[model samples]
Target: MIRDKIRELLKKNAEAETNFSLEKPERAEFGDYAANLALVLAKERKENPRKIAEDLIGKIKGNREADIFEKIEIAGPGFINFFLNKDAVLEEFKKLSKLKTLLKFKTPKSKIQIEFISVNPTGELHIGHGRGAFYGEALSQVLKLTDYKVEKEYFINDSKESSQIKELGKTVLDEGTSYLTENLKSQISKLKTKIKNLKLEKPKNLYGEAGYLIAEEIQKDNKKFIEKELGIKFNNWISEEKNLRQKNYFNKILEILKNKNLVYKKQGAFWLKTSQFGDDEDRVIVRTSGEPTYFLSDIAYHFQKIERGYKKIIEIWGADHQGHQKRLFAVKKALDWQVDMEILISQVVTIKKGEEIKKMSKRKGEVILLKDLLAEVGKDAARWFYLQKSLDTHMEFDIELAKKREEKNPVYYVQYGHARMASILRKAKSGKISPPATFTFAEDAEILLIKKILEVFDVLEDAIKDYQVHRILSYIYELVYVFSVFYRDIRVLDSKQERERLFLVKETKKILANLLRLIGVAAPERM
Candidate 1:
């Protein structure tokens, strides 16, 4: 809101239209906020940047906008730095009572559908899949809090694959016939654990029946683990096989492409003209064997999403699908769809022990499964570690660091800050002392802490726009770091201004709790 007010003031005085950047100055002497409007305007208008900054300052000073800033100065080449008035900062803090309402004004509400963790119902979800799961859920939470109508979806790929079917058949047969090799025993044990209702009797169509049963068991287990262990609940579970069975759905997609002149028969296969829309080569939608390819099914699935009338569709995918993004976008272009679509690719996650990096391969049966990771550290620690980094950056999960219970662990450090604040609030409640109307923060640490707290709404607003939920982690770490300093240097319960300090502590606790909830982590009241 403060940034908006400053932008409004700058826009009224500028000679030409330009996109300006307002950010916190890196140095304390620069000011609370800095704008690079003069630099931008200078490049466009061919004027001295410092002169442009001076002129902007003159116009702002002439208006006598005392409530916004106490001082405005030109710094560096063209940067305009503004020191916010202390009273204005205090007024912003007072609005914390209506914080939720304040956040709603930051973004336009829209109906959005986000699909993530749509792994095939063939095997257990490994730690790689956990990254997308954590990222998607956190993004969904932020969107919901920011007033978007969000539909969290998991697309189940239950269509039959011949190789997978045979594998399932062998496993089931091995278990049923009691030829229990170590690997077969392990597979049967895991299957039984995941699918409590599994009845592995020998059927006439061995592979077909076995595949169906395996997929059913996987879908059930995946849903339970996601909802109960990971604390994520999807609004919709869209089954690909079910959608494929819908009357003429696949046919409708082919017809749409044909009408657009985007399909062709080449080498005894039906190909989509993906190269015309920017793909490296044309892609086959239907193979020479007369069976539709996975690409065709994906196109139909997106068409179904479009028909559902969502304004935006977001897909969280793994890095392995990086090359598929262009083909998917080409399909959207071929269909001339109006809905906005975004594909976010989460990079690989490597788990590390003390000195050795653990390599994982589900096919090789040498992998850290999601359930195992959850069991090792916990849902809270796992989610926090996965969500703390950018989705596009490859991350290494340090098992040792995650297991630590002290300040060295970021999750523990943040939770400890909340627990400490909760303790302070509990003490204040027991004393039955109301916070003072007139407050004075004599300590510099208290002022810094308030500044950090006031910046959270802006940080969250940026996170929503950029879809970089990692920013929330950075903000929490900084907020808690400031709080740690304040807690160490300033006395709250036994201070001369106990009630006012307690008020600050209470506000900090609320923010910590809200942030933890956004990332799907628990903010424990006690360490």
Candidate 2:
């Protein structure tokens, strides 16, 4: 938001148009924000950078935009550093006294659908799915907090035509595959009675029927575990077989591709001309035996998102799906539709137990179930550890550090900071300690903490723009570190300025709680 203000000031003041950058300086003496507008202009005009910086400052002062910053100084050959007015920054940030009012960005509301953790119904969720699962849920919460209409969705690959589902069916029939586990055996046992009740043909439709039914049972258990244990609730559970294929939606899309001459017969199979639209090569839409490929179903699925009125569709996939972006873009090009599509591939995760990790296997075999991790480290720690890392990087989950109750643990450290603030307010029960009539922060610790707190707006803006949820964790760590320094340096109970300091603690708690909620962790009053 402050960047927008500087952008407007530069637009009205400068003679040339250049894409400038405004970044927060790592050191406070360099000022609150540093801009490279002068250097960018110097490159174009072939003039001295410091002279350009001085001219821009003069124009900014003339335009009366100097009120936005306390001082504008030129540093190191053209970097424009802006130190914000302390009182003005405090007025804006102190309004974050409630969790609901943090940032309050009035972005235009558009419908967004985020599909994540679409693990096939063939097996229980594993550690690999946990990354996208938690990332999607936390990102959805963050979008909703920023006033976007967001929905969480899961795509179930339950079609009997699917190779994975057919493999699951093979396990059910014990016909060469030994993937049967306790859960599959239980589902197969129930499938026998259901098949007997239907009185279907002996062997013709038996394999597909058995596989389809067992997958449905497994999906129900996965849904329960996700909602009950992992605290994730999807708004929609889209079925590949029932929702699309059963309704002939897949055939409809195939016909559209064929009618446009986008599909051709090659080697006895129908292939899409994705190479014309930027794929590495043409991809098969139908097998040689006339079965639809999974790529065809995915094309149909993305079309369905647009048909259902979602302007923006984001998919969180696993690392295994890398190099899959090209074909999806080709699909968009072939359809000739302008839509905002984002696909994030979350990397794998490793677990460290420090000699006490209890890793239980799922139905298919031992692959490290997500529920076991949640059971061992707990929901809050699991969420914090997963969300603290960037989605594109591999991560390790250390169970020993996650379960630590002291300040060495990151989640514990943030929560304990909030709890300590609450303790101060509890002891200073001066009947709703509100700020005095003329309140001004005069201490160095107070000024530093307030400046750090004001960056919450910039953090949220960046998260919304880039979909980088890890920024929230990084911001919280810095905010709390400065607050800890402020807490140690200032007196809050029975001091002459008890009311103003208590008010600061209360507002800081709101900001901390709101940020923790974005990561789906709790900010406790007492540890």
Candidate 3:
């Protein structure tokens, strides 16, 4: 938000549509914040950037917002560095009447639908699914802060025609054991009588019916586990079989494509001219054997998402599905997808302990379950570990580090910072936190702590720009690092500055709790 104000001032002074960089300086002595407006202007005017920077600094000093800055200096190559007045920055934070006034930021209403972790109903959720699960949850939390109406949905791959459900049927009917884990065996055991009735009812394709029954039970248990144990929730549970096929969406889309002359028959198979819409090649929508390809069902499902009126749709999928993204984008172009659609591929995760790396061999049915991981290292640590890295990077979960209870573990260190702040507030017998009308103290440590707290807003704004939830987690770590330095250098309890320091501690606690909530992690009063 402060960055926006700074940009507005730069634009007003430049007297033209402007684009410039404003960010924190790499080193502390450079200043609290730095910008490159002078360099951008120099490019246009063909003038010395240092001279432009000096003139711009004078203009900024004339504006009312200039009062918030303690010093505005022109640095190397016309980079403008801004140092904020401690009292002015604190006043900006204090004007908010309540925590929500600052925390629940408002933006223009935009309807968004985020879909992730749509695993088949064949087995328990693996550690691979954990990435998308926490990623989607954290993404929804940040979106809500910016006043986006985000619908977190899970698509159930329960279509009887799906190869997975068919294979699961063989396991259910005792014909073969595929994806037959102990938990799935329990589900099959519970549905034995129904499986028997299905055997008696439809002898020809009993695998499909039997698979459907067991899949329903498995999905029920999976949903319950997400709610109770993992603390994740979904707004909708859309089924591939019930929601798309039962409604005849696939058939309708086929008709729409055919009428538009986008479909043609070649070599006894129905082909879609996907290459015309920017795909690398044409693709088959239906096989020569008269079975629809997976692409047909995907088209139908996305069409429904568009019909439901989401202005923005985001899919967080596993790395294995990355190859399908270009074709999906082609489909969007062919069908004139009006909304903003993005697909993020979360790379593979491997468990690491010291020197050895344990990668999942799902083909051999050797995998780690998400629930099991949570049981091994508590839920907060599990969630934090799942989201520590960017989605594009292959995550190596350091189990040994995550298991540590000391300051070496980043999550533990952050949570400990919140606990220490809470302890400081409790020592002062503070009531519900309220920002004072003004901050009368000015110390290097205290001012730096406030700057870190303000960066919380910057991190959230960045996440909204790119939907990168990891930014929020990263900022909490830096915030705690700054808090540790502040608490170590300055005395808060039984000191001359007890009153002002207590106020700082209480504000830090609130800031930590808000950021932790955004990342779907717990902020403990005591650890």
Candidate order, lDDT descending: 3, 2, 1
Q: Give every collision pair in model 1.
A: none
What is each predicted model's overall lDDT from 0 to 1? Answer: 0.81, 0.84, 0.85
After superposition, which runs of candidate 3 have C-alpha atoms over 4 Å from their true positions? 41-48, 96-102, 429-437
Candidate 2: tens digits of C-alpha lDDT, residues 289-315: 788898999998888889999888899
State the lDDT at 9 in candidate 1: 82
The residue-by-residue lDDT of candidate 3 on 1-527, one tens digit each, is 67778878888987868778888787988887899989999999999999999888888899987887889888999999988877767765564324653456677688899999888888789899999988888888888887778899999988887767888899998999888888888888888888888888876557777788888888888898888987888999999999998889889999999998999999999999899998999999988977678888899999999999988999999999988988889989998989999999999999987899989988887799888888888888989988989989999999889999999999999999999887788878445645555577678888888877877777777788888788778888998999999999998888876777787887778888878877878888997
In order of appearance, the predictions have TM-scores of 0.91, 0.94, 0.95
What is the total number of backbone clashes in candidate 2? 0
Model 2 scores what on Cα lDDT?
0.84
By TM-score, rank the candidates, best first: 3, 2, 1
Please give the range of 10 consecutive residues that has the lowest summed lDDT in model 3: 93-102
* Per-residue accuracy of model 1 over 77-187 as CA lDDT, tens digit each: 999999987777777787763464326533557789999999877666889999999999999988886666899999886654334544565566453432223544555
Query: By lDDT, who's the top model here?
Result: 3
Runs of candidate 1 exceeding 4 Å displacement: 64-66, 98-102, 161-209, 429-435
